[model samples]
Target chain A: MGGFGAEIVAKYNYWIYVLLMMIGFYAMIAKRNLVKKLLGMNIFQTAIILMFVSAGVKHGAAIPILDKHEVLEHGVHAASVVNPLPHVLMLTAIVVSVSVTGVALAIMQRIYRRYGTLEEDEILEKIGE
Target chain B: MSGNLHMFVMAAPLVGALTVNLAGRASRKAVLPLVLGFLTLSLVAALGTMAGVLEHGAFTYTVGNWQPPFGIELRIDHLSSLMLVLVSAVALIASFASLQSVAKDLADRQHHFFTLYLILVAGLHGLILTADAFNLYVLLEITSITTYGLIAMGRGRAPLSSFNYIIMGSIGACFYLLGVGYLYILTGTLNMADIAARLPQVNGTVAVATAFAFMLVGLWIKMAFFPLHGWLPRAYNDAPIGAGVLVAPLMTKVTIYLMLRVMFSVFSPQYEFFQHPDVQNLVVWGAALGIICASALALGQRDLRRMLTYIIVAEVGYMVGGVWLANGTGLTGAVLHIVNDALMTLCLFLVAAAIISRNGSLAFDRLQGLYRRMPWTMAGFTLGAFAMIGVPPTCGFFSKWYLILGGIEARQWPYVVALVFSSLVNAVLFFRIIEIAYFRGGKGHGHDDHGPVTEAPAMILAPLLVSAAALVLVGLATGPLVSNLIAQFVPVF
Candidate 1:
């Protein structure tokens, strides 16, 4: 029981991310509303971003930015700095996520305007017309 | 100096997209020539880069002068250079082919169509050239978004289908992103070669396995590999003829190339995951089933474009299965098929576009006596169809021969049988269309009157004929291509 508790605590972030991803995946596949699916997609993307951010965490490291005085006096060691690569990469990913969301929302608007419903089944039925 | 040429390969189409868009706004008439100029520039650059790669072998370009493990890298190797040339050449041909059809099908959205077309081509170029995993993801989304827009522009139900494609494509891209994140968590580098070097240290971990699963699933969805192929047929079927001409040929083929890249380049083939017999068996059998089912589905389609989309699904299975066979012969076949299938699909789709542009429909019934109405177009279609059926001396047969040889070497009898079965199925499929077009008398449509041969405009016919001739030329050139290009690049087992 103690081992289980420790394991859960140690990897809780991954568990949470998995839970969020599953929620998003379920909505994407199971939900009928296109907008709801899009929301799920956003949630899914955000969860991945969270995972990436968490992956960059070094338990006791300082911010990646260096102090001028410390740098001037003595060279800063890389060991004290948190990993910044994931953060940088995720910044690009976040922008991509936003663009995808924008395009998807616009597409949803077009879908709604054309079919008069955002429900997938209803849209399909209308398309069959 | 030569390294910068790779940058030009990607930039030319990008600049073309912008110039075409701006030119469209300024003078509608200027758009076509401007698009042609830019794409021509891009094709020339791609060819120049290909020559450089052939002479110098594989090299990497560090973007912004930042070195790898920190900066985005673009690796131009035999494989990528080969794909770059294929993509730009196809885009050039398809865009040229679009001259008449875009005017007809896309009445008002001609400018927007060309803009998105160029963007799609640029995105594909970027996808093939980028060496950073995250950069590949970004380019994948670019290609996909542009694709959704292009597909939505088609008449009737196209918007809905494009919406469906968006859902599937975004989910696929996100899955890929998550997989890349997993890899980043395991190894701190995003450069593919760097990650490949680092991955073997943690090679068999659950995290690595999960990453592989996620990435493969994501790419399979994108490639529309049989079971995950729900979004492809409708999107391709409902797309505007001009858009279909571009997307149907390039989209899935590029995804397949990405899958191969991830398999061989990003993850070293020596990894136990690739060597596991269970995984190999699963892939080969899954691909075999995909071929049979997709070919059968294609046989049932009445519409020409939809039928070819299913065949694309089947051809995708061929490449996947060949690569999974894990022998030099099989991987060679897969690589060769990548080039062969791209040209074959481009030819077929161009023929479809020509038919629809001139005759106004793609139904099998409407094709009765089409050979009389459009002789050159029919001739091109016949060449493409012969290639599809794996007739001897067409490029398609040589690739299949290599794939079958690989299957035999791997002792994958089912895959071999499936290939043979698919060829027969393809023969039936094409012959059925041929029978209707060539042998049958036009009854309801009165198309048999031997009407004046109104071939597709030179814009379309020229590319069609060039691609058709290319079918035979590439077939003959397969030996040199395999020896000079693919042999050096296929991973040493």
Candidate 2:
């Protein structure tokens, strides 16, 4: 429990995900740049993928696939089957998030054309104008 | 009709979506009737299906004839059948509203517009019918993505509003997926009935709480409840008139239906049998605050579109407050209001679209003295406005009446006050615009930019008149609807 260095390495990926989500939220609310905000949103959503993947992790797990149905079934002395469902769900969510980001970027492109700047302050100023 | 009418009930709209998309592109000259014909057919199918449910009992269509737990189920229980009919009925009205609006604005993009509109309708139908949680999420995205494209077709700030909506909508979908994942991890099943039966075994598990919180936040975001509703007003206001007619009226509502499904069926122990008074109190408090704050906000808005947006937010509070009251009357009111609110909101937005079409825009200042010039439009708006405020001789009143009675039954005073205050606030908000429209502008004629703006074209007018009629009809015939349709659908739990 007191092995600090080992623990950090073990859950390093999760920490990175948290950092990315925070950066996105920070950029969304704090930063003035709209392109950067969209970038932040993309990073934020990808962070959820990290969360889901980490939840699926097992220390001594296989890829959760086998030729025989018996191997997939629960057994007394069976190797831990890696959870394939989260991986599958994360795949769908990733596609949706990317589609949303693509559309957001398109909107950002339009906003740039109409307002002439992607910075929040400048855009609001222009909208006011 | 055949006894196996459930298949036709659900599949007709899906086929219509496909056919409309195909026909719109292939027979460009035939877009109007092609789309309208499909919507009208869907209406008949939905109503016939509802009638079947009323007569033949609740129907379940097993996809590919696969049984539950191993495969998906599409159920048309009293509640689901009722919701489907309401949704399709409004879609029919919206199609009429969209006909003229789309023709005038998007002649170049007619096919794409109708395609997306019908696909959105199909997605909505799929959402209501699906008995699998994952299937619901799939259909939810189908509507949301299509909704983004539809809203972006608006002329003014639609692109921006659509963008904001996408951001919030993505967060919501992800939250819902997270909840579904939690349920799957705990129960090892995706089918809703299977999950409900299995949930009792793991009633107080941490997974259940995680799933509940995830779903609560997710549905709140999707339904645009209070603080989470920042995206709604702009999206509703900015979308093209036709898009507004479809998306504004249905989007939040279908999400509300999902929330109800999850509350009653999926998270049965969480909402119903567990008897979580604290959670109930929290929801009631939030809904009350939403009603009060939104009404206040609506009172201050100068833009007609933005004002309608705020009213939508407040009205969500009405439904949430009613549902969370957790009584027979409360549940019935909440469920019935889902239909009533959709029709009324559709009426208002369609009429607003007509107003927008006639004038260059619907800014408050521009709407003055429109009463004499456009009596029919004004009358439609008046009906919608009165209905929205929950006044008498309208279905809107019954929803509030039941909600208040439920609140009183639940020994709730603040919510009753919230309902009353919200109604008054909206009255003040809407009447100011009417007063300006009737009294304030130059004598004997209209504004400078819009020269002698008469009533809108029939395509727009027909749908609006239909929605307005539905509001009055539902209000007048509240007893039969409450007893016959809604009570059977929404149980006390």
Candidate 3:
């Protein structure tokens, strides 16, 4: 199975995650467009969420529903449960990322209102005033 | 909970931060005491935990009272308790020093500043106390998000900087989460102690190395380690003096502390090849370059605050170097330097803020006669400068002394040279500002208004003095303090 896992190789989701992360990071660093930066930031965060969800999935595994009868049994009793933990954790992270994004975009709107431009270089020029 | 004042102490400041926000609407004067009272309580709790650690092995408080693997735990070992004390102590001083600047800068928004400050405090407290790796990630987010907010509330351009900060900061946090996720997938656990226990069984795998790389890279980003420090200088430069007080001093130090913990605690030294000399060699070279290179970068800066911001980049090098030394002396020095650098950085920023507040800007030429008009402020600035230069009898000296000795002990000549070169560079960097403040910009103006210039108001001065006193006290008792508090906490790795 481990050998089979090796043979099955990388998927589209993994490629997209890496590409999206790099693009987001590049937009953040290279682009001087403030609005473009926010869009980039959101794009970057979405990639991580993708990574987490992708991690939880296997080639073949059922949803992590526990067997009800094995109440307090320990050693290897509940194998192949494909881990509900990552999914739960990722849910919280998504909420947080979204909440912060809302606030950031509002601030971006205010910045545009004040500066009359979304270009970072122009806003910086005005600030230098 | 008998002799264990640990829970309450850490909890109280956060409680104060939360409650003060709620209560600030009722009375403004009452707010300071409320916050101060909790910080004092946190300090007392730290001392109690210290006593607790000595008596009982270590106190662990799992959230929701569940078992370790299933629940989030707040562990108060000797190391965490010391951090609690240091963070609270700096926080107490900064909060007091904050009143005037925050009042002037934030005004009706005082409550908001305090709220973010407390939340940041809570995050720092959480980071130090949390026993679980995944839990650390959550707390790290809380800190980073609040830090962005705190930086955003500064005078101007703050929101822009904070926005940029969030982008970089989120990437760092995500990297950390990925690292933790990797570990969990490999080891089937998230608890630090549990991971340490289990890792030895599967020591030489590619998965663990990848996990280590992921975690280290994430932490390096947070620590604003040289190349990854793109977001830091502007964030510091743009934050308000009061908010700057907190972020500039403690945030990166906490990140560095966590890096050390991960390197030593989560992946034990003797148990694995995670602490390979190859990794240490790579990191130390990065550290040395950060030290020398960032200092050189600072020399080119024209803005006073921007220069200080670059110095922070250099200081990270100092601490990272000590950690990579892999010796008790160097680790102690790095740990000790964290507190020392905090004081030095805080002092420099406070003085620069005073200068900026006095003048309309922090341009180098605007600082002439600053020393004469604000003698006490200049005196404090002088001490901080000398300390940054690592002069004898200052806290900075001892930190450098130990780090250099570690360099010698480890037979790393380049690191020792980097230390000497950086010290010389810092002297030039800080004194350049002093010279401008004195010779070029020091001419007295025929004005009577204080107007956020001259010496800082009592509120700001109070916290400034408290940290300055810590600088001296650490210098005097360097031997006993680092041994009892930090050295023992040093992970064998």
Candidate 4:
């Protein structure tokens, strides 16, 4: 319960999210292929959704839905249930990410049809021609 | 009743998009009338909303009778309504101007083009009106995706450019979502006003600073601030004239408006992030560098549309720097430039479209004798170029005047120098085109006897004329627009 072990245990979720995000970001910028960049974008978006959902979790908390009998017997406590707002927001984010990936893939298909290659520099050379 | 007008403005374009899709691609005649009908309706609704704001100052309309921190709200303040008026006005005019180009450039894909165009319109309106932080991201993606669709429909090399745009734009949107996640975790509210009230208590935390940095960088990239502007020149150059006219005017300008909105409404003007001298210096200096570099890049362009896109990057620098100057005058200048730059860019792009439609090229070498070829379009282009150069009695001049005044007040000499230097660069860039077109590349040929003066069709020339005239009218009326519209709403630290 002391020093580095305690600190890592407390914030491991955030650490993982940040790590995944950096990997995605690096692939997006440093990769050569169009499909790889698209994958990197998806990974980046998924990492964000992960961060949001993790932020909403609480230890020893029940589902957000309330039971009438429990509410009648004992008043509802805010901390007893996981936060539902971030989850709802992330649902929309997930849908947006899906659509973005679909559109990106469609555009990549067109690029392939036009230029016959998916590499960044190769496409440029084709365009130059 | 006013809220109903606001709701109608957001809904009409969406309804039109669906109807146009259902009408089928065979009925090409039905699309333009339907698109124009919906845009006109939205324009009337937007005007009503603006009148309501003028009468009532600023107000909020809650959805489903639910209060803030829970259900979404539409905040129709002076700022949002002003943007609404500008967005709808430009949409209507741009759609009108698209009639000829859509037929010429996208003859077969007319129906699909208008459908996506209307959806992009609806998304922009929603983005400006929403009070929820999460809703803005949703609408931003809607606009961005529709833009990608529209831009990809262009003639050549467009697929590659649009794909590059998709990659860069997705990264920007993801960064924005990550920033919003940070803010939501810090304060358990999704409403902007609620977050603003709760933020000061946890002011200087690392999380808050990180959130600000993320959001700022994300928006800067989306707005194509200097270093991140790689996607704009190519994408806009390759896009069809119709989509280019609509997206070019509204996209970056709206993002700049969002930056101002977040600075004032979501983060409070007095927040330490804005008040920190080092942070302020860094942003202002970055904006300054952006101006010089973009202007320099523009000087090297041969294509007219590509050069105009670089000018957009430099104009973004103007607005961003004005806002970061952190004075009432600077904020006013920023807001004023948002309206003026939108009109100026619309005018210029419309002229480019007209020239391309007739002359079959936007390259400088092909533009020889254009002044005599299309005199009316050339006149409009002249007004737009003068505005871009910050000449007196143009709207651009007034905004630049206020920005320079703000720079002097803030003692930011570098921003002032960049402002003056960019102005000179714009003059040189624009006049070079003028030299080529008017003098026919110095051959001293009076008029080409073989080619007659074929002006653009009425649909195209009319909007160009109206927008060019509006630039001057807006400049003349800047006194009232500031005192009545922009001055009262600027955040006071």
Interface CA RMSD of each prediction in angstroms = 1.2, 1.8, 1.6, 0.8
Write model 3 residue lDDT over B1-493, tens digit each, in one string: 4354777766887788779898887777767778778888887777777777766766788777798888887787777777877787777777766766787777788877888888888789889988899889888988888888888887578888888887788778878887887798788889998898898887878878888888989998998998889899999998988888778889999998898778777986553334477877777888888888888989989888899899899899989888888777788889889879988887877776566555657877766667666767777788888889988788999999999998899887888899999999988877887786555542254343323345666666656666666677778888887767776787654
Report every candidate's CA lDDT. Answer: 0.88, 0.81, 0.80, 0.89
- Could you tell me the lDDT of residue B431 within candidate 2? 81
For model 4 the TM-score comes to 0.97
Give the worst 10-residue stretch by lDDT in candidate 2 chain B.
B442-451
Q: How accurate is candidate 4 locally (lDDT)?
A: 0.89
Q: Candidate 1 docking category?
A: medium
- Candidate 1, B73: how far from true, in Å? 1.3
Runs of candidate 2 exceeding 4 Å displacement: A1-23, A54-83, B1-22, B269-275, B440-453
Instruction: Identify the superior model by lDDT, candidate 2 or candidate 3.
Output: 2
Query: What fraction of the native interface does candidate 2 get right in terms of contacts?
Result: 0.24
How large is the C-alpha RMSD of every model relative to the true structure? 1.8, 3.4, 3.5, 1.6
Q: Rate residue B66 of model 4 by lDDT.
A: 93
What lDDT is reached at residue B226 by model 2?
Answer: 93
lDDT for position B415 in model 3: 86
**Which candidate ranks first by DockQ, i.e. highest?**
4
lDDT digits (tens) for residues B69-136 of candidate 2: 76788878888888888888888888877878888889878888888888888888889889999888
Instruction: TM-score each candidate.
Output: 0.97, 0.91, 0.91, 0.97
Please provide the root mean square deviation of candidate 3 (C-alpha atoms, Å). Answer: 3.5
Q: Mark the regions of model 4 whose C-alpha exceeds 4 Å error after superposition.
A: A1-5, A68-74, B24-26, B272-274, B441-450
Model 3 ranges with Cα > 4 A deviation: A1-16, A58-77, A80-82, B1-4, B55-57, B270-275, B357-360, B436-454, B491-493
